[model samples]
Target: MIDILYFAWLRERIGHGRERLETTAPTVAALVEELRARDERHALAFADIAALRVAVDQELTDFDAPLKGAREVAFFPPMTGG
Candidate 1:
């Protein structure tokens, strides 16, 4: 199972914080397609990919990043360091 975490507006839109998922996705993009197909909430949360940032195993990564052996993936708005 893979752990998926949602932060900020993503968590609010999806109505949850995190979840354990059994998936066949090989990449983050594929996982997004699966989630986007789940419901309106997920679609809304992922609607603007450009407004989001992702991390795999706690390291920032692209949506095309390989998910092989991934234990956790997090989605959040871009962090601004001031």
Candidate 2:
């Protein structure tokens, strides 16, 4: 099982902050596809992949990042500075 965390509007849209699930996805993008298939809330939250940033095990990574042995994955909007 892997811990999936959603932040900011993602959390709001998904109606929760985190979840733990077992998956056979090999990469973050594949995991996203699985999430999008789970429910409307998950689909909506991941609708725009370009608007999101991802982190694996607390380290920022791209959508194609491998999930082998990963324990946590986080999704959030890109940080902006004024």
- For model 2, residues 1-82, the per-residue Cα lDDT tens digits are 9999999999999999999999999999999999999999999999999999999999999999999999999999999999
Q: Model 1 over residues 1-82: C-alpha lDDT tens digits?
A: 9999999999999999999999999999999999999999999999989999999999999999999999999999999999
Which runs of model 2 end up more than 4 angstroms from their true locations?
none
Model 1 lDDT vs. the true structure?
0.97
Indicate the TM-score of model 2. Answer: 0.99
Question: Against the hidden reference, what TM-scores do the models get?
Answer: 0.97, 0.99
- Clash tally, candidates in order: 0, 0
Candidate 1, position 29, lDDT: 95
- Lowest lDDT 10-residue stretch of candidate 1: 44-53
Regions more than 4 Å wrong, model 1 = none
Best by lDDT: 2
Task: Give me the displacement of residue 17 in model 1, in angstroms.
Answer: 0.5
